[model samples]
Target: MKIISAGLPRSGSTLVMQMLKILYSDFPLQKVHGYIEPKEGQIRICTYRHPFAAAVSNARIYNDLSDEHLKNSAIYIRKMAKAVDLYTEDGVTLMLRYEDFYLNRKLIVSSLVERYGTKFSDMLVEKALEYSSIERNLERQRVYSDFAHWDSETHIHGGHISEYKGDPTSWRNYVSSSQIQILVSILNPVRLRWGY
Candidate 1:
């Protein structure tokens, strides 16, 4: 079966892809950001983040906090919401939250392995965890330093972890109250649906 890792731009999709690549070494998996038409027998692993956090991350990464960017981000979030909703309804896709990746990675890996009906050694699982750890990816970011130098295999680009504080709510630190209100107004429905 083919495996596809998908999600929004600032979601944990890349991290999911990296871990899947290592844990499912014998299988072929691809990272396709956002939605794609799934094929039969394909395992679609879709990741999602809180919309407010996503908007803050996008703003910081692109250095754009204008109204235009906010509007665009809302549009992107809506599209991702639709994709995730479809994935959820399909019942075959594995829907993962961003917080679970950081807080319960091993469990996520185990669930994926169980769903795929594959057995991997403990050492292999550990290797996948270590290789996809945030620290290692940060080191990769320092080395890459630019989009042109990003690691194609792992998809670790520079500034990938902009201002990570091990807190999902850390987005509040970078954005103003007004911006937060705007984001909340725009994304509250999605937040409610996703339990954010």
Candidate 2:
């Protein structure tokens, strides 16, 4: 199986990937390339890149893809979902929801099985089950750190998207305009699909 942690930056994708790495320390990964090549019979994944790589590399639509541009994020999300489905038909790219994923580990596994076919082995399923239980609280850190700092420090922001007291406004300064456009273009559809 190939589970892509597809959430946008500052939305816990890296944090989630870091936690998952603890469980699969033996796996060969490309953090820069955004890919993971696991052991034989083991699962592999490319968190942000594989899906957005195409868009990021050759983005004809350089706009923010904000509600102003995309107009209907839902429509775009469905389209992206269908595209991802093509790569995931045989389970090469499983869409792991970051929201409910943190809520219930076992239930998430059940859902994954149902969506990807329940034929996965108990061991692999167990690994998936273990994914949500890891101990990592970068969000909490981001929240705590946000208030303590001001000035130029805020420009180097990271970790959580809504850490600025649920104020996404801080993201405006944290992310570069160009990068913002890239992410909005790639992730708004996802946010729309996810109803974010």
Indicate the residue-level lDDT of 113 in model 2: 54
Quote the lDDT for 77 in model 2: 37
Give me candidate 2's TM-score against the actual structure.
0.38
- Residue-level lDDT for 36 in candidate 1: 72
Instruction: Specify the highest-TM-score model's number.
Output: 1
Question: Model 2 residue 6 lDDT?
Answer: 40
Q: After superposition, which runs of candidate 1 have C-alpha atoms over 4 Å from their true positions?
A: 146-149
Root-mean-square deviation (CA) per prediction: 1.9, 10.2
Cα lDDT for residue 100, candidate 2: 42
Tell me the TM-score of model 1.
0.90
Which portions of model 2 miss their true places by more than 4 Å? 1-12, 31-42, 45-86, 105-136, 139-161, 164-196
> lDDT tens string, model 1, 24-121?
77768978765677688787898888888887777666667776687677667766687787777777888888877767788777777777777778
Q: Which candidate achieves the best lDDT against the true structure?
A: 1
| Candidate 1: 10-residue stretch with minimal lDDT | 158-167
For model 2 the local lDDT of residue 176 reads 46
